[model samples]
Target: MDNDEPLEPETQDEPETEPAPQNSDETLYCEAEASVAVDKDKAARESSETDLEIEDTEKFFTTGQRELYLEACKLMGVVPVSYFLRNMEESYMNLNHHGLGPNGTKAIAIALVNVSNNDLGLEGARIISEFLQRNISSLWNLQLSGNNFRDESAELLCQALSSNYQIKTLDLSHNQFSDKGGEYVGQMLALNIGLQSLDLSWNHFHVPGAVALCNGLRVNTTLQKLDLSMNGFGNEGATALGEVLRLNNSLVYLDISCNDITNDGVSKISKGLEVNESLKVLKLFLNPMSMDGAVSLILSIKRNPKSKMEEIDISNVLVSEQFLKILDGVCAIHPQLDVMYKSVQGFSAKKALLQWTNPMKLIQGYADQHKITVLDFFKSLNPKGVMTMPVGDFRKAMIQQDKVPVNLHQVRELIRKLDDKTGMVNFSLLKTVKP
Candidate 1:
């Protein structure tokens, strides 16, 4: 009997009935017949379990996640605890999704210490918290994003991380953890020395929460990467993070994009960068920083020319040609730094028509290198202006030179839907000067 494979129902031809003499030998045959009947009944019972059904989820998880799930199932009496995990082991082992409610979570948590791809939404918060509280495993890598497990989940997870010595990464992004929840997470970070990465993006982390997080970072030294993007952390939060950058030596990557951070906040961060040396990558896209803030940041990095900091994202931020020229000269000299100056333009029917047909015209960056009106950056597309610029070529240039991650298939689909007839864009017709 192999444990890995389920027991199959037995199929043996029944023997024909034979007349027996009324003697002592007849008693032994009756006993043997009863035992055979019981064995046949047991096989039928086991075969019924193979009918268990489990649906597959779209998301896929790594091998470790699947192994953890299976270990838990086996501990919880693999046959009795059923939500189709046992039947469809190969197909739906990694996909623990919406169907698993609080009951399902509690059932699995009976044996599970680590879990992922399980969207045990609001209903499963209490169950998940209880599991974390009682969980015995040391190496815990929880990916509970999009669960909507608000304040309680945050506090519970914080408590778990505080005691657990093997916490590697805690990804709570896209949860309803506001600044209040963030405070709990920060408090935990101050104590937990084993945690390496923390992602709190797409939550409701504002100034007060950001302040608490920085307060934690000021003392803690294990965390290396912090993502606070898509939150409501404005200048006040940015200011606190800048202080963290100044004090914390372990942090290397910081993403603060789409947070509504402006000139004041950016300037303060620049001041921190001037004195700091550990940070290598900074993402500041979609912020409303003007030329002064941009210039201040460029000059701040120039002061520490040997700083390990190599990349800065200023895409969609208000930038002047002078700042672009200054940045281009700095990049040319260092050659180690890559200043991403991709300015994303909003959807425009007219602009799309022009950009699809001709080379794009912009104010700075590559265009300033040759002292040309940014159109020279895309000269590779057309040498004689005879070849019309298409979205495919534009995507290539954006990806190759500027390092803009634009998939030509996706970009082409968007452009084709916008202007199906031409299937081209003219970048030279970009509106450079405003009225």
Candidate 2:
């Protein structure tokens, strides 16, 4: 017999059997099975339909809804309100028959603030404040970044912060708050003690605004992380803020990028770091610092052996090989000085030209010929100091020399060949063509 073949019943003598009985239990079992099958099919259909509806709803958001959502995000410093509301509605409906949506107002009220429209993100704040007033013990996280907020709007926010104590994180980045508006918010920070992370980046917080904020930081101990990037604070402003950092021990992360801080500003901050131990991350990108400023910072890092600073950014500052060597030496010695170099991005035309002039391969070859490292040769050329030269001047200087440095010409030829192959070079080569 084949292993896969079906078995056949064997013929045998059979006995007589009693007739079947009609009972309610049999009827009920059959009905229950049928009902279960129907319910399963309905559930499958409903689930598929719900998924399709959610997809369609995602595709159908109106401009008004998007604006309202963005505004709510700026005021409350959280994810878009619509997204939060949708999830909250689903949760509420799943938990109870509370159809808290367009279908149920009470459910909607319980789940969402319904601030569909209104300027300065006040409606959402008002709703959240009102909810807290009713509950008295609920915790919330508010993030209101990238909204166009004016002075009047900031006042309402101050009022909300004055009363509410549950909100822990408040992000107010990218708002159009000037000195007056920032002062109002600063007042709130001074009195309110519940906030931990306050992000005020991309606002118009100039010197006056910073001074006002320093008043709050001086008194408030609850705030731990503060971001003040793209606010245009210069040396004086940073000096004032540094004074506050010197005294305050709660702040850990300070971001001051895109400011007009030069060597003087950095010097002031260095002074603050001398005593300040709580600060861990300090961002100082897009500042007008030369090698002098950089060296000063390195020296300070070396001096302060007990500083808690783990990372430092000196990007976009005019730096040289000497600066890099010093930083390399510092890293070798300290092992904790996490220094970052200015990347190729946003390099000035002059800087880019210089990089093209003195390619790294050429420098390495020149150093090899001189029986020393590239760093030593660079130091020898400018014994006292080497300022960051412009790209064009550096290129011209390299080519104008009597003899082209070893490997310099070779690297340039290689770059030209690659550029030609990639269709990037449309001009004639600078030097004579070599095989």
Candidate 3:
């Protein structure tokens, strides 16, 4: 080779590449086992993490509930009551008559709980409405009875409840709310699907409000118990409720007592009872309705083939012999029904017919013996000169030997003939009688 080419011949030894490592079964097995071991470790770690997450979630909910109580106590500006603090998880709480005014009541409402008779004024109701609208809490039963909630508070609460699907029972009795509040409540009832029991007694729901409420009930199928007692709902209200009874099938207990309903109203309601099939208890006590109205109502119930009426309370309404007879006939057919009444309106004693053949003559004799005009005699009986007195009071005077010299049976008959259906005896009517 030439000298330049010969220099290239002194080549360094290239390290021989070892044959690529031959795949061994044992090595492949070791690698596969290592991969499986890694996967198992990862899975164990993930499972432990999931368990920890579950534990954390439980702790979070518990802490949240306690936080609600703590927040309420803070807003109330008082230490947590020991009973509530000790039983933080208890569902029922009775803090009635606690003197928790607006601020304290607001605090309690934020917790979405009960503290009835706590003087929760309109401000407290506002707070309750705010939380209800937020839809965070899961409160079901709400008792705000004896709270001083007004129309605005009622509107706010109704607005919240219109969309909420949680609350089941609500008590708004003994409040100052009136027709405006009642209208709002009616609107709420029209939209609400969860409420079942509502107590609106001792409010000022009159004809318009009552009609609106009943109209709402006509469409509602959830409410079971409704207390409209001690309101100003008159015959118009009764008529509206009668229409509701004709259509609604969910109402089971209806307390319309002490609502100034009269014979016309009862007659209207009787028409509904003729068709209704779900009403179990109808409370008509403490009303101005008479035996005729009560009798008509009972008869209507009897006429219904699908009536589920269990009890009809007309305890304060005066009954008659005819009413008792009709009731006996109805009870014979529906022995499961119970009718409650207090007294009979007419005289049933044997001597009553013989003694009081002419009640006007007996009264005229009493006035002549007293040497006073008939009007003057009534004026004497009525000390206040109001020209009217309770039938019971007039009956008491009639039975006094020195006053009217009439027997009990005779006095009852006289009052029955003279009663104005308002349980009042008008003195002006005596002027028309030629006794």
Best by TM-score: 3
Model 2, residue pairs in steric clash: 74-144, 76-142, 76-143, 77-142, 77-143, 77-144, 78-143, 350-391, 353-391, 354-391
True-vs-predicted CA distance for residue 354, candidate 1, Å: 18
lDDT of each: 0.59, 0.56, 0.71
Q: 368-392, model 2: which lDDT tens digit per residue?
A: 8868865454334332435233222
TM-score of 2: 0.53
Which of the predicted structures, 1 or 2, would earn the higher TM-score when compared with the native? 1
Residue range 1-435, candidate 3, lDDT tens digits: 122221121112223431222122111111112247766574343323311122233333344344555455454443333323434455665443233445544555555466567676766676667667767766788888887788988898899999887889888889888888878988999999999999999989999899888878999989999999999899999999999999999998899999999999999999999999899889999999888898898899789978878668898987887787788677556544667777666756764466556767876887788787777876677668777887645754554437555544455556656678765888778756555
Q: What's the C-alpha lDDT at position 236 in model 1?
A: 94
Residue by residue across 1-435, what tens digits does model 1's lDDT show? 333333222112222332222221111111112247765574344333321222232133333334445443333223222323343234333322213334335335433433444555544554445445554544456666676768777787788677664667777788788878878888988988888778888889888888887888888888877888899889998899888877888887789999889999998898888877787778998888866777778777887765656567886665555665787566554444556555423445764464344222222544565666544544554545633564434444444454222322234433333332443555534344221
Q: Judged by lDDT against the true structure, how good is candidate 3?
A: 0.71
Where model 3 places Cα greater than 4 Å from the true spot, the runs are 1-86, 91-112, 345-435
Q: Look at candidate 1 and tell me the lDDT of residue 252.
A: 77
The best-first sequence of candidates by lDDT reads 3, 1, 2
lDDT of 2 at 107: 22
Q: Which stretches of candidate 2 lie over 4 Å from their true place?
A: 1-137, 332-334, 343-435
